[model samples]
Target: MSLNDASCTFESMTSPTTLKTSTEPPLVSAVHWTRAQWLLLMVVCTVLALDGLDVSMVGVALPSIGQELNLGTDSLQWIVSAYVLGYGSLLLLGGRLADLLGRRRIFLIALSVFAAASLLGGLVDDPAILIATRFIKGLAAAFTAPTGFSIITTNFAEGRERNKALSIFTTFGASGFSLGLVVGGLMTSLSWRWTFLVSVPIAVVVVFLGMKFIPKDKPSAENSGHDIWGAVTLALGMLGLVYTLVSAPEQGWGSVATIAGFAVSIAVLAAFAVIENKVKHPLIRFSILKEGWVARANLSAVGLFGSYLSFQFIVTMYLQSVLGWTPLGMALALLPAGLLVATSAPFADRLIEKFGATQLILTGLTALGLGYVLFLRVGTTPNYVLDILPSVVLLGIGFALAFPSINVQATAGIKDSEQGLAAGLIQTSTQVGAALVLAVTTALVSGHGQAAGTVSAQAMLEQYRPGLILSAAVAIAALLVAAAPSRRRVRT
Candidate 1:
């Protein structure tokens, strides 16, 4: 089906609570539409931004969180693990629920949940409670993020207009991560709790604006009950996988706990595959994996976001410990990179128009790899402009180039019926991949039997240097994935 044809269906809509239908004109037809539509667009964009911001912002706050809670290194790791585990595991389930129920309904409810979760996190005294709240917040985010993207894909026109909106949405999300670092640093200075509390007001505003401006969701008749067992298995399997990876660095990879996690995850995921094959309305349709561009983009998603974040993790340590930059200074130094992403993104849409997804992804990966390679040259001496700024710029450009193109390609051919699930899969790949890669990165940086954060600056840098090369290698691997397209045309 063509984009215009997809637009034709949205002309008829239902009330938010009802399964009824209507005959309004296709919202997609109005590229230069009303102010209300623009408001809706912006609100959803902010919602997506909040999701991305939560990930990177909380990362910067980890040290502060550890200090305030008197948490151990393993506990600090759980701060990240809890959120990634929740987000990655429930993504497909969340996305499927949106499709089966209503996007607008799920979106609003999730926002409220996020606000509540943030409040819980702020008020919590125990590290376990804080981690639980973070997990719940991330669970809420898993629902909101992909649903927001699916909303954009359905509401916006296809071609240039849709692509433009996507880029703008992604730019906000990208900016949110970088901005979160800055905001997190400042907030953590005041109190680490603020990192959690701050999101509440933003969520409140998004919910209000969203309810006012958001369009009603019309359900598909075919979108009935979703796969129950798949959700169960996927959740367990993903949590197991994330836990295994997170624990492997501290405990030996061959340790009983680590081995158990891996065994459980692999077995459960294999069972999930069988259940998916047997079930009707499976959370993920097996055939979707056969889609060439979808497969390619998802493969790179693993590499792109995973390696990018792991690189940031390394840079954060180097800046704070080795160079002795303050948290605020670390954030400020990365600010230019954030701005570069915003500046480059508007043009990235046009680049996709010219070079297409395949070429853009490969080029972006190449640049991203080079940026990592540049980081390998960083000395103990701190020269932000000379050493870090150039690499940051390249990474910013690389992400801008890579993100939208891959999104457009992966989602372009998918039907509206399954777009939510498809979006979920993309995000799932990203966070899950990041979680796995982060474990490896930390393991490499920490070295064998070395306690996290118990090393001298010189020793830490020595271990970290090899990890940077690993990040570069991951980027190169993504480039290779994009380079070798299957013989079949991308599903559309």
Candidate 2:
């Protein structure tokens, strides 16, 4: 829910030297970076930032989309969910592909996929085709995101250098989301199509630079065939569940269609567990989850990101439909939050050292929960200074502290070879959480019994309140997870 635009994981490369399962990394941060290493980092970071930009811009673009396409609330919701559905479902598989195939290959291939999708998306006339393009873009991002992280972790030594690289990476990633809010707004003023079209150039430039400067990866000798059945079942299952949630408002929770969809999804996901346990080259090692940090960190990520994105979705809607602001005005209003995220993400490492991951995670969730609560104060009339600014500032502060810590917690004990898997799992948690929770909350807003009958500004406020309350509740749950007492602990 946290990303209106938020996310990534996976890769591609070929070489005679077989990539090994050795726990050692290829590059060490202890050594000074070559000009080449710095360039690689910058390019990869830019690509990651692009993903965030896509998300933020799209959030603002949604209102324009609805007006142009003459879409109802549910169709508008699908525009976002389509992307989340594809991205969340494939993340784990994408991560494994990176490890088996090669990070560089997957990275390059995924970037190309993303650019091509964006180009087509901008040209589409039908909402269905546009939704399809969003899904395709998400699939490409699922591969690119984790692969980029793997590239960084595998290259940098643990400790100051790795930490520093990650901090800088988080900064750029946040920058994309923040900047995208503004850029999308400005571009949307020209036409909403520009939002989808704009990423084309950025992705193309990044791929071109990547081909030259990004080092080639050795193919894994351990390259086993992918878990076809597991991937298929998981994808279908997640899609079904999301569809059920999205349709529940209309279909009724106890309706035959809703029940059947939920039933099938559960059965399929259970089957996926069976296949993972039995397979020799399981898509993911179930045992890795035995580590408490890995499992809990991922669960917390789901809640944290879910609430964040869901909140953004509602806020953007309120800005355009209720307050009657243009997309550019909405972007400038949110510019502070983005600025806060950029300024604060760099210092998160220092905060981690001082307060530790657990405390910081707790603090971040608390800030986020409070921000949503503040947002509930908005009415038919607007007061940006008091009502919205506080929420954005708090949300920004919360994300800066939590996002990087969540990553550190998820991947800390993972082996260098398995870093991609760890990255994929957590990223999956982020996307799936966003996809599912967003659907559920959106249904809550538009669902049959709960909100107002009309789609007017006052009616939307009534609908939006319930969703914001849900967002706050989700954040509280994440905070509780962070604060939970546990016998097992991993490095924060």
Candidate 3:
């Protein structure tokens, strides 16, 4: 059964509720959406953009940070891995809280926390403290990202209105991260601290705007208990799993500590599964993963983000440390990927509607795979135009197509009450996937003596090349998963 077989429409993959007629009168097309709607959309988009900005900005600043702190690659990776650990681990709980307590409240509080963390991170001279602040920021984002996503889903109608809003929202996020590279470069030139400080003011402004513009809504009555044990086990399990992965290469992959860490992590997660089965109001309803599209979307997210972040990390290192490019020059080199995503925002929804999300995902994955493959040819003194620009442009196009579609598919059939659940699942996949893949990539590169901070450019390239190959392998794996056929079908 070909995925392109005329019978397998986009709708076939979504939940049954997607087919129902709206009780409310139809609003105008998304382009003409009202001021209030637009404001709400902006609120969520800005929050997501802030998340993107913080992550990417820090990425470009990593080298400066390393030099300033006298930190090695292993230590530098913790700046990123800590954030992913905090964000990925608590996301399920964050989503459940948003659904149970109130999206507006959760979103505001988390945004506030994020602002404070950003400020603290900028002021901190201690590497551990700086990394701790990054963790706090990630924890804050775990709540804000999903709540914002759910807010958009609940406000906009499912089919077209929601689609357009999501495309713009996701694009802003991609743009924020994309553009953050350049912004990060500029800030890093001034002082690496500025990258952390820059987002504080923007976040504060967004919080004030959110308090005013975001409509208040009651919590879902369906959820009765907080499922305390479930939250604890899930958090611990995720933390342990991520920790083990992050530490494995350092500890020696086959060492007792690494083996024990994996064992403990698996044990805790198993307990979490048991608790979820028994608890009346589980933090996560495992049944959600049983939804074919939902599961596929999450796996696809893991592959997409895992590969891209790992690729970006390797490139940032190669360009700055090895090639000796200025921060601004490196940012400009990678700007095309972000630019393509920003430019294509308007057309994304239409593309999904016309070609169907399934096809677009397949197309996106193919482009992504090809982009990674192209980058594998990169040498110590490779031509920017011939060796890099083509890959960057292709990656941008891949993201422009895939990110929004994945979001749409993941939440399509979910009830409004469970929208946060759907958002959490996908975002968890993204962060955790990135954390896991990046840990492996870092280990691979670092193990090759790239950690000495004195290796020659040619030697550095040899170490980093394996990370690039891993990125390509990840994309191809995701492409295969996306191409796999679903057992059930409906139409878009």
Candidate with the greatest TM-score versus the true structure = 3
On a 0 to 100 scale, what is the lDDT of residue 401 in model 2?
78
TM-score: the better of candidates 1 and 3: 3
Among all candidates shown, the one with the greatest lDDT? 3
Model 2: runs farther than 4 Å from truth? 1-32, 66-73, 224-226, 246-251, 448-459, 489-492
lDDT of each: 0.78, 0.78, 0.86
TM-scores, each model vs. reference: 0.90, 0.87, 0.93
- The clash number for model 3 is 4
- lDDT per residue (tens digit) for residues 155-254 in model 2: 8765455666776786687779877989988888889999999989989999999998888887555656667887788677766776676566667778
Ranking by lDDT: 3, 1, 2
Give the distance in Å from residue 486's predicted Cα in candidate 1 to where it truly belongs.
Answer: 2.0
Predicted candidate 3 versus true structure: per-residue lDDT over 302-406, tens digit per residue: 999999989998998889878998889989999999999888888887777656677788889889999999998888888999999999999999988988888
Q: Whole-model lDDT for model 3 versus the true structure? A: 0.86
Please state the error at residue 309 of candidate 2 in Å. 1.1
Measured with C-alpha atoms, the lDDT of residue 147 in candidate 3 is 95
Residue 54 error, candidate 1, Å: 1.5
